[model samples]
Target: MLVTAEGAVRIWTINLPKAGNAITGADFIAAFEAAVDAANRDTGVCAVVLTGAGKIFSAGGNVREMADRKGMFGLPAIEQRYAYVDGIQRIPRALARLEVPLIAAVNGPAIGAGCDLAMMCDIRVASERATFAESFVTLGLVPGDGGTWFLQRAIGYERAAELTFTGKTLDAATARNWGLVSRVVPHEELMPTALELAGQIAENPPRALRMAKRLLQESRTGALESTLGMAAAMQPLAHHDDEHDRRIAKWRSA
Candidate 1:
């Protein structure tokens, strides 16, 4: 992965173009996890964008390895389950820790776990050439990357089920219509559009943006009262933030 910064936003590019930016094994996850940690620790980084180095955003798993019964696909059924727990499952957990907005700039085909990866982001913007597929079923396999959960949350249970069962591929426009991706731009414009959105998000006060992100995350699963109570707890801290005060002052000046 190649990580670069633009003002308050960080762009992470998956660099395995030769393999269609396929993500697999321990090393990739560890590095990605570390990158997320680094972004969180840096107060200056208020937003992030993830994209691929070449045409494909991600191929998801390594098909060649799966065919060879190597790595996570090796051995007994029970061991395969454990391998998932220690391997791919860790991605959602790592992404869950991000305090700011995460944008997936889907440049091309996001197949199977790749589709799940895009779903894991807080926002998704796709190139006109981009495609998404929950393709595990086509391979006579199931989603081993928490696509079960993420897919439903992204495009509703019914839509998710259809894709999962049929392993149908969706074009960028179809993905946007189904609410999987927020926007679909011409392929050449994808990165520019994503970066522009990231800049908009990055301009906000960092602490407040983080608090809003946290609240938004909790609202998805928490009950009404619990979510409100959590917001109440965070509001006072936001009220006391120096940056918030500065923003207020700037507004008054305007």
Candidate 2:
């Protein structure tokens, strides 16, 4: 795992290209969550850009571990369920608690859990070479890592169901057509495009940016009055922020 900063956008590269960038085990989960926590602690960060170092963004779970029955794919259905809870499942939980927005830069193949990881982000951008698949069915398994919940929300229920059921692969253009990704760029332009978008988001007042994201999440499942109530509470805090004053002054001068 490697993390770098470009302005207020923190870029996270899943560095295990040799292993196809598979999010292999509990150690990887702990490192990933720890990185997320670090980003949350930094108020200066307004967005995070997650991508992979090599051709594959992530191959998802470790198939080797599954074959060996050693890691998260441990034997016994009950232990396997608990293993998911104590392992890969913690990632989505940590992401849900993230203070800033997350942007997925799908550099290449994002299969199975990798696709679900992208769906967890606030926004998604794709490289022309990017591919996506909800492939748990191919392995005779299910999306135990919140894929069912997040994938449906990203696209629609029908589209998500089709992908999950058949384990179909979607190209970047098709992904955009299905509203799975915001846009697709040349593979070489992927990071630049994602960073430009992140820069636009990162320039806003830090506190307000986070609060606005919270309101967006609230509006997803909450009532209209509930979203409004959160906005009402957040507005006062935004008004008191130094960035608010500076922005106002800058606008006045302009």
Candidate 3:
């Protein structure tokens, strides 16, 4: 994994190009968790862009490792369950805890767990060369890494069901049409587009951005009344923020 910062925006590149950027063992997850933890503590980081090192965004799990049953797949049923809980699952958990925005710059094919990984982000920007598939069924396995939940929320139940059941891939255009990705750009322009969007988001007051994201997350699972109540509760805090006052003053002057 490679992490770099551009002002308030951080970029995380999955750097295993030769392996099709597949997520293999626990090390990658551990590293991701560490990076996210560090970012959460760093007030300078307001937004993050996730992408792959090479042409392929991610192939998902390591097929070779699965075939050989040499890693997570090799453990006993109970141990394997524990492995997922303590390992790859940590990625989504960490993402959930991230208050800042995350943008997935899908540069190529995102398959199986890779598709789920992109779904975990707050927004997705796809390259024209990008494709997505929920292909766990093709491997005779289910989406154990929370793909079922994330996919359904991302693209709706029917579409998620069809993709998961058929393992059919959707091109960038189709994904945008389905609302799986917000935008599609040429491969060469993917990172710039993603960073540009992240920069726009990062331009907002940091505390307000985090609170707004929290509200969005709550609205996903909370009732209208509850969300409204939460919004009411947060309004005073926003009003009291010095950045909010500064922005208001600047707007008045302009």
In model 2, which regions exceed 4 Å deviation? none
Supply the TM-score for candidate 2. 0.97
Q: How high is the lDDT of residue 40 in model 2? A: 86
Model 3 CA deviation exceeding 4 Å by range: none
How should the candidates be ordered by lDDT, best one leading? 1, 3, 2
lDDT of 1 by residue, 71-112 (tens): 767779998888888888888999988998999999999999
Q: In candidate 3, what are the lDDT values of residues 1-254, reduced to their tens digit? A: 99998999999999998888886567788788888898888877899999998889999889998889887789999999998888878888999898889999999999999999999999999999999999999989999889998999998999999999999999999999999999999999999999999999999998899889999999998999999999999989999999999999999999
Highest-scoring model, lDDT = 1
lDDT of 2 at 99: 84
TM-score of each predicted structure versus truth: 0.98, 0.97, 0.97
Worst 10 residues of 2 by lDDT: 66-75
Candidates sorted by TM-score, best first: 1, 3, 2
Residues 102-143, model 2: lDDT tens digits: 999999999999999999999999999999999999999999
